[model samples]
Target: MTTRTQTLSQAGAQSGILPIIGAAVLGAFLLYAAGFAEASVLHDTAHDARHSIAFPCH
Candidate 1:
């Protein structure tokens, strides 16, 4: 019953919703980790990342 264009249109619309949900979940996890994680671990990870990116942490 469906035409090719209609089928592709439906698929395209469905695909966009997944990335929005994924970003929301990732954002929530980062927020929780930053707020509740041990200070030393968080600081170490951030320091390493900064150096890895060639950011001067001094």
Candidate 2:
């Protein structure tokens, strides 16, 4: 008993939820890899003199 517009709207709304879910999952994986629950060795290494924030280490 739905019109064409309503049917399309429902489809669009359902499809929209997936990208949000995917983004949340990706963020969680990144945080986990960053050692949120373990040792963040990569992050620690990035803080060394070899990895300066400003350009031109010289």
Candidate 3:
């Protein structure tokens, strides 16, 4: 007989995979879009993010 903790853990593990897959798909889509996007557009979108992370953008 499985304990409640074991049951909850199993359920959580199964459900956790969906979010991981979704994030991976989203990341891939964003990467693909960025690849085909214009340089100016990319620069504009990431300009603030680069500055926040202390990355040189200029």
Indicate which candidate wins on lDDT. Answer: 3
Please write out the lDDT profile of model 3 over residues 7-57, one tens digit for every residue.
Answer: 998888778577888999999877654443447888688777666766556
lDDT values, one for every candidate:
0.69, 0.59, 0.72
Q: Cα-based RMSD of the predictions, in order?
A: 5.7, 8.0, 4.9
Better of 2 and 3 by TM-score: 3
- What's model 3's overall lDDT? 0.72
Tens-digit per-residue lDDT, 1-58, candidate 2: 5698899988878787778889999999865554343344645643343234432222
Q: Give per-residue CA lDDT, model 1, range 1-58, as digits (tens).
A: 5798899989888787778889999998785555434567775667656556654454
How many residue pairs clash in all the candidates, one count each? 0, 0, 0
Candidate 1 residues lying further than 4 Å off, grouped into runs, are: 1-14, 38-40, 43-58
